[model samples]
Target: MQRVRVSSQQAAVHKLGDSQMTLSPKFRLPAARSTITDHALDFDNSLTGEPLIPGFPDDVALQCLLRVPVDQHTSCKSVCKRWYSLFGSKERFFTLRKVLGFHDPWLFVFAYHKCTGKIEWKVLDLTHLSWHTIPAMPCKDKVCPQGFRCVSIPHEGALFVCGGVVSDVDCPLNLVLKYEARKNRWTVMKKMVTARSFFASGVINGMIYVAGGNSTDLYELDSCEMMDPKNGSWSPVSNMRTHMASYDSAVLDGKFLVTEGWFWPFYVVPRGQIYDPMTDNWENMPAGLREGWTGSSVVIHGNLFVVTEHERTKLKVYDSGNDCWEVVEGPPLPENICKPFRVNCWESRVYVVGRNLHVAVGYVVENYEIATGGNGKKGGRFCVRWETVDAPGSLFDLTPSSAQVLFA
Candidate 1:
């Protein structure tokens, strides 16, 4: 039997015994679709009379577009003027995604090339387990990794890369760059009032705060400031009791905690501070809390957890009532996930990015209890389930400096 080739237009034609009918042109597939470049040329056209998707209601079309993978958002925005307007505005697009339950959690890794010391960002789509690169940051000067502080307003789909040092000149920079996930674009925001490096920064009540970092002369800075993301304006905040650069930091219970981690040689105890937004003041961290904060930290469900930086890399949760750290009931950190890692969490899951971009995810359960004996003796325990994912070979040369989770 011979097969007949039907043109797209003819494919829409139907026969009904004695009668023949053709579907509406809107229902027919075009033989050749317009290229993105062609659509881009009409970007300036007004969307006042244009439908988001042809032959469909704007609301239905919006729902369809909301389901599109975030990686393809740029291409979708280039499809038409109305789409560009929707995808380019964070308030409209991200707000809709949040309201409609279409946003997804993504892991953003700030990594640097070990050989060249060049810094870049990579994003992991948690839902699909895929990786993609974001646009290059606006910094023109050479900079070092781990010298800047990154913070985000996850629900707003925004990430901010704050102050850092210029590697070539050994100068601190106040440059602030904002990445809008919805549009997949970067905007250079207002610079911080103080140039700093290796600072402690966190978001509280939609405001970004930075404190206790190195200044231009490599002197530890005790000065602090807060930025209202809405206006991109910075204002002075109360200074820390002492000048200390952050070795690890977290925002828990609506406050920012910064610790100058323990140093080798066992000389002196490290210092830590907690900043309360409501009071706009800083308080000394509890002795037990700071003394045992031995590694990077991430807050989950209002509880503070840490992955130890020492050998074996144990997981621990802070017992605030006792002001001490308790071991989490879970397997040790994956052998493949080595030291020099970065940690971040969302909801009950913890993400640790180790050398070579290897990731280990820990699902945590708090306040669990285990029965010890027939006498009914029970011990309170925190449990974690571990899972690991390997990095692509292309990312093997990159080492993570920071990791953040954003919803988009």
Candidate 2:
């Protein structure tokens, strides 16, 4: 049997025997700086003195530390230099979590205050059912929600907030900011080649891609670019067939799909485009797919699902074989989860955040059934169970613009 001391001041001890190890109830590390930016400039990374936990091998200690809840990491890092080195470095802490297959999905919502118009980010820990506030984005200029696009590389536990318009001036920006979940820090990354807003952005093969958005002069841009996050550099990609701005976009089956969405006047069909990284080219989206795309889209289990924009929001799944969308069997979007909601999914759950930060979780059933519509068209049918999570009263004035899921 081995005994490990977690904290000397607290005199907390955990016994490691043949069975699994559990931390002592009193084992609490000292509190540290809440935000990385507070001490990032003066922080030291040199490891010295003791192992992560005294009286245990470093490797064995790591397994015990890995079990710490992510929310407690800030406090745990303050215990010692060795512990800080383990949790402070993304390549060390986050990469190990991925290797060990300890993924806890957290939803990051980018929202703005309705009265003040100040933008901020809030994270929902799906596992613990709690909320955490991250460091403010490092943008010098005031910006509005929906103008910038947020995308994440889930496995790496990183999120990128790309170009957006200035709140007061409406001028587009090329700025990009990255937030590392494990470090609880934000780092501004290399700017995009072109300043853009309301652009289409997504991750393909671990690379970031942006295309067809409004420029500084408010003209729709036909330009596109790709960035390799490893080096924080951007390269030009083939332009779209026509200058277009995305109303909705999704990465499905490793391909990037962008649709302008149907505009009013009811007769003119919206234009859509598809980007294939392998071909380094763009193609027109199929008429059936683009015309029927009426709302926000999320890809789950390799299938495209959309929450319609109409008065009574309904969930619909795309049928690639039939090239059309069929409404899935599920409860209508919760009355409380009102319009202008942002949607994102992880595994089989579809998360929708509506006005005032209210959330609706929809679980999609895997075994789909074949059903015939009134038009006698065959379509796949799946069932969804809906549940709602209310936002804290303090955030009642906030409205979400975008949401992304990251695993840590």
Candidate 3:
């Protein structure tokens, strides 16, 4: 570092004997008379440390910043003003967001660079298309279990991820991994009672519901459990009448709706069942769904809507009062692209995300359109369009190749 000096009285510093350090009359001190007086004794200089730098090449310095995991990256910016400026810049901040959004919208995706054996996590921000990586967890194995699946359920402001099989064959896992958005780190939670994979889990009424898993015998589990995040305990619920293995469940109208799973060893269940936790019972909703009924069910606009992957699947709105399914018309995409669309209710609208190909390379997002027919009616056709990648679209763009729907 270069050293510079100046007189204590001046605010600016200068090198010794530099032209700017000339001592003229302007620098002259006041002359003292020959009279002496009693003086007070005091010598204190406690406040002395490093000075703050006001400016830095933020854009340039930021280039040196490797994307750290989300949990620890914030501290890197907090180290100093220069670092803070570089990391918190609008561009860099947004870039981190995009990374998190694409990695796994639901905060489920974990990445391991086998070469370095570094494990990291990417969390998606649904509102704003962005990415956030979690700090490295203690368990650093590069391999995740072959059939591991992660689910994130929002509690308060944080998201709790639970029940994934560990990579180690000797010690297969039923451990719960939690990612706190405010803290930005992954903390291991209490393990589950049963070890399983490919199950359906979600939060409903301050409790997490986990059900249906593929067991060692290739048979699906009919059992279900409820987890209380507050108490850190689990309890059993009424098991399904039949095995709904590898099924999807959604909470609507104070009831849990499970749909589209293999009823038999190989055939898919065309029936829909509604489970009421309040009543501790399950009621068969109806027999069959429209053909190609792949999308998850959702309750929206004071009604329940069953959307199909294709436009032809149409909109089947259920009237709870009348006990019936009504079809609404609209523009729809190809059925193959999203036979089983992942449906989510955000804000006041219902959104659907589906991949264009079976390989799951590309995806699209669209809003369900509602229309009115004759006599100024309130209902008619419902339609959806593809969401562009550059814009908020079907795929959560984490990096160039990997993508998923935004969830955070």
Candidate 4:
């Protein structure tokens, strides 16, 4: 692929081959079961002591302070030294955010309207079930010209968009954009190491990873790289074992799973590959995992759930413990949704926004072990429910290219 500058002000694009780091491949795959440590408990149990704010008593102060939303933590921190100490512990702060029911799921949908030849971002406040227009992306003509893949920083309520093709270019895009929900604005970030489209992406342990997509000349790339938000820079990583055009990605048990979206001749594709950032290695996935992951995939409570086919598709859960897939149902849903829709998993809750402006919110209530399922292979069973909400208005007829979830 030909290298191009992102812009005069953007960082120079880097390639995997340009770095001195060895691009070695190890075939070892981690256990299908993830061994990554769970997040630290979000709450501090020792908050019954003396008050940090001086005037208030400990118990009384705790009640009043917990009411403050997570987004306002920065300002609350500036109140005094003690407030910073209390809010500085991210785990405890998030725990409070969750415990007090302050964390609300926010959804972002990227729509490129061919009718007007423009791209606009719409954000839905799921808690209140309403939509708000966000700042326009910088990519001119058709933003995310080919198709955009969105990754979210739920804790910080920020979003990143990558991949997609531009109207004027023969190749896809390496341009990346960041959306800060607090400010409801979009800004260009460091360009990707490689220009590609339809790549696999996800956020694991807060790092953004992109792998396998269409490079120049219709080449399906086997390469991959990652971006560290802390430093606002990109670094090359080892490539995947196979050239995969990742259509769907999910983070389960601390590992990023990528599916080989499609293949020529026979349509059958395997379960795909799983990358363990801890070991910096990629391993082939177990067979049959791909079929279950046909469309959207999300992880809830350390368990994997996927929706294949269309809007009304039955939800399937992968029970890593039993090594079997299970069907789950909780709420009834419309038989079909707009052909182009999105499923986003935030804090285990799934939000589907699409067609154009329609939205559906869902959650998995429970999982059950099935006597038999999955092409005669016995699978587990689960329950899920989804309800649709009418968005404010339909700005265009264009389908949503990508969607993400955050809490703000």
**Highest-lDDT candidate:** 1
Q: How much lDDT does candidate 4 score?
A: 0.67
- Kindly indicate the candidate among 1 and 4 with the higher TM-score: 1
Model 1: how far residue 58 lies from native, Å: 11
Off by over 4 Å in 1: 1-101, 369-379
Q: In each prediction, how many residue pairs overlap at the backbone (N, C-alpha, C within less than 3 A)?
A: 0, 0, 20, 11
Rank order (by TM-score, best first): 1, 2, 4, 3
lDDT of 2 by residue, 1-408 (tens): 333435558654633221233223232222463332222211222332355678976556666776665567788779987677666654456556654567889999999888888889998889776776888888854787888999999878899999999878989999988999876789989999999999999999999999989998899998989999998999999999989888989998888898998765567899999999889889999988998898899998888999988626888889888898888876788999976799999989999999999999998875444222255443346767789999889879999999999988
TM-score of each: 0.78, 0.78, 0.56, 0.69
In angstroms, the error of model 1 at 124 is 0.2
Worst 10 residues of 1 by lDDT: 14-23
Q: What value does the lDDT take at residue 360 in candidate 3?
A: 20
Cα lDDT of model 3 by residue, 149-220, tens digit: 444443233455555444444333466666554344567777677666666676678787776666545466
Order of candidates by lDDT, top first?
A: 1, 2, 4, 3
Candidate 2 ranges with C-alpha deviation above 4 Å: 3-101, 264-267, 368-379
